[model samples]
Target: MERSLAIGPGCRAAAAAAIGLTWLTVAPAAQPRAASPFRLHGTVEPIRSQLVTVPRLTGTGFGPLIIIHLAKPGTLVKAGESLVEGCRAAAAAAIGLTWLTVAPAAQPRAASPFRLHGTVEPIRSQLVTVPRLTGTGFGPLIIIHLAKPGTLVKAGESLVEFDRAAQIKTAHDREAEYRDFIAQISKRRADQIVARGRDETELVEAENAVKTAELDLLDKDLVAPIVAEKNTLILEEARAKVAQLRKTFDLKRRTEAAEVRILEIQRDRALNAWKHSEGNADKMRIASPLAGLVVLKTIWKQGSFGEVQEGEEVRPGMPILEVVDPSAMRVRARVNQADVTRVRVGQPVRVTLDSFPSRQFTGRLEQLSPIGSPSGLSNKVRTFIAVFSIDGSDPHVLPDLAAAVDVDVK
Candidate 1:
């Protein structure tokens, strides 16, 4: 039972051969490995965006604006939609309001091929603001009505309505002044006409008296010495009166013309002021220039920065809101200098939103920055900015969302 059997030399050789073949097959399989693709992080941003601000009025006294109504944030809108409304704090009543249209400039398309990180942005957007009033002094603007923020609107829709009371009142005052000036000018002209007629009659009478005096002088020689001297004196008096009347007529006409000219100038100034006020009143209401979503700007208020609200006063030139086109969005990404050369414009890439990992978008490189900035890691290293355009639309593909981009080097 304990007896052992010895292996032959041929059997040992065969076992060694089998082991070598298995090693060779496993080594080859382990030596070859697949490389991972390069990825860059970026943020979603609107390609076109405008800052909304209070308009700078040309004349003085427009200040301390009060918001009466405001649009709810995140509204989808078309071009010309109403966004915000305001009025003057001192306004007593509302007046007829009109809409103002804004237009965005066109953006040129570019291509990029790289993985980079950037912000989401609309390709086009516009800033909504209170309109500037020219040629008149208006009081502070007050918000009367505002479109809900983030509203979807079309062009020509009302965005904001400011209290038109101040503008309307100013217009009325200017109009009244203009009309009064017109009446004064007319009355003055009529008075001048009556005075001219009276003066002409007096002048003619004086001339006739001079002629009568000359004829009477011819008879002076036939009369007594005292009578002749008296006739000569009468003739001299008539000639002197005729010369005085003629000079007065010319002076009066010149003075009256100058007076009328002054009134006309005043009337023109009043007319211009009235027109400016009327236009300003219409401008009180702000409208969307393009179809997009409404975004309210964060502003400093009461020692902190926040979105503007109804009944809050805003100064001229202060930022208030924005209308952004959501359809066309892009991501601005920063790429390492070393990887910059690997990417080119027009290269296809995959974009994944960090907020929603499940959502992935296909896009292409739109642009690459020519210059590079110093990297955080080292001064010698640089990073370049690259823009990628998302191919299609998604409700969640809004601006400012963080995204990961995978560049297809192959």
Candidate 2:
């Protein structure tokens, strides 16, 4: 269950305004803004398709800390390696608890249940974003020390680091305490001191107790293959590509699926990894999830990164990547305020990019926003978001590469 992070109401307004403008040139133009000075300001926003912002990896409960060390920012390691040395003590606990009783299979889908289609990943939850490590307490996470990005790490080798001394101490402590608890339970059972699992509450309590103890171990360790290697690569590429695609989709996710959003390079990487890595998760990692040569997105910004820096901490869930699975690409642009009434789904469209000043792409109106509003930069003009899939492939065409689109409302 996760909160929906759709484009905000404000962003939607700007989008609507843009869509409405597309209609201004059609049928008959009774009004020509009458004047440019009074017309609200408008931006040629290259829309963004929906993004499956990767979820932050987090711990379940305290446990035997597992620490994996990497050599650098983006090191490639093999599965079954000790990123941080750990065994699934907590996982074992969870498994043991499951032996208690089988829960019903009818549990409704979790509010944010994983619904992966085409290539977009499920809402990330099973994977938690690990926090920044600063030589913390006894619990150790596998911290890899990579010499640099793409460094090849060996199978079962220690790539990520861990505080061995602290982790060892905790693990030993847990072992001793667990043994003591086991002894106590055995004694109680021998004397028939008290009945256990006699009531629902008792069974529930016992289950929780086991889970807590086990999670302590699970949290400390970093397990490999958190997700399948193929899927992990797809996710990595999708995030890495968002920066470029940001201009293409202009924040309208309804028309495009997440699978179509990974940058071209990343998609290539995924393809390569699948061909090689024998399906390894650690085989793919872009240099700093925020940067890859996203020259394509700059066209829409009139500059690269739209004033955002490589090292800046972006708001969580921003389209961190821009992808071009061209077969799935769409021209999602904003129509200006005075033209909202003229836009409609299935209306034919013509799009031309500033980068491709000589070329024009065609598509039909796939969607129109219900409301129109101002752009983020205090613009007087309003807009609506509209989307249309590209009819065919263009080698030079790219997401957010800028285009001049003419929609045929007729």
Candidate 3:
């Protein structure tokens, strides 16, 4: 049985209001929405970059380098542009260069979906250093010339020049020694020829004497007994003299040949030394291998790390400068291990430089490291390196500039 109660207008209005409030609360929860994309931070850098270092001098007893010339920072340079000049001295000195901007290039169409943060670096780069010498004990190199930093340069241009006085002097000395040996060898050969001729004359005379003695022996039977005996003794003496001369002649020839050979060896050694010194002198000048911008490296100086200056001393193999090709640039970034799966190779990305937030560039994910490294925040957390290749060129998109990257994962 249904029980009907008396209804009032106010009760009906209050019941309708309660039903409306319940519907409002549940309606929004039933709808679907999209998720936010993950973003990564990185730095803008050329894909091609190089580090320059002080050339490690080859051989022993090389003194310290003294900088005589240095390029000013921020100067545009091309390949093979002179950047520094130096010479060897009792004290040491150094210089450095830093590559800055790159020319614009065509964009790559491939894209990736993830964002990562890293520094920009060039894919192709070259490190410039002093040329290693071929000769030993030549003192330190002194900088005689250097290319200005940031200058545009072409391939195979001079980047550094060192004082070649010592090398030149050494080469001259070696040449003199080599020539002296040559002269001595020539004289020895001439003397040996003269001595050999004399010995041959004596040997021929001895043989003739032996033949005469043998003829005398043939007539021994026709002479008196005592005379015949004397002839026999004379023949024996002649034969003995000839045999001795023959043996001595062979020994003398061998001895003379050996003496000449010794001189030749000495001459060859001196010639080699001379050639090495000359080659080393030529190597004192350093050249760039590719077209790019010059970048000076910072080195320890006066108790602080800074740019190397002229008239300073530097050791061999210390990094001094770099030539970077800036046409193509890429950003290297790190992604959290947990979020790495959200990103894939070839995903499209948007890059914005922190220095110029108003400027944005498009790129694609180029590479994702297979292994993860410690994140430094927590022992359990790891981060993977991600490389993003920028598609278009921006003059302001220089290396080492901090940048933010965004990817549309949806």
- Which candidate leads the pack in TM-score? 3
Which digits, one per residue and each the tens of the lDDT, describe model 3 over residues 41-76?
999996865556556765677666666767665455
Give lDDT tens digits, candidate 1, residues 1-410.
45444444445556656544222222344655688888999999888755666544445555555656655544444557665666666542432232333345344334434445667877888987656677635545777777778798899888877788878888899999999999999999999999999999999999999999999989876899999999899999999999999999999999999999999999999999888888887888888888888888888779998987776666656667888898998888898876887888998889998899899999998999999999888897789989989997999987677898989885
In lDDT terms, which candidate is top?
A: 1
Considering TM-score, where higher is better, how would the candidates rank from best to worst? 3, 1, 2
Tens digits of lDDT, candidate 2, 46-79: 2432222222234576455333322232233333
Candidate models: Cα lDDT each:
0.79, 0.42, 0.78
How large is the C-alpha RMSD of every model relative to the true structure? Answer: 28.9, 43.8, 28.4
Q: Which stretches in model 1 have alpha-carbon errors above 4 Å?
A: 1-114, 135-139, 224-230, 334-340, 369-385
As for TM-score, the candidate ahead, 2 or 3, is: 3
Candidate 1 global lDDT? 0.79
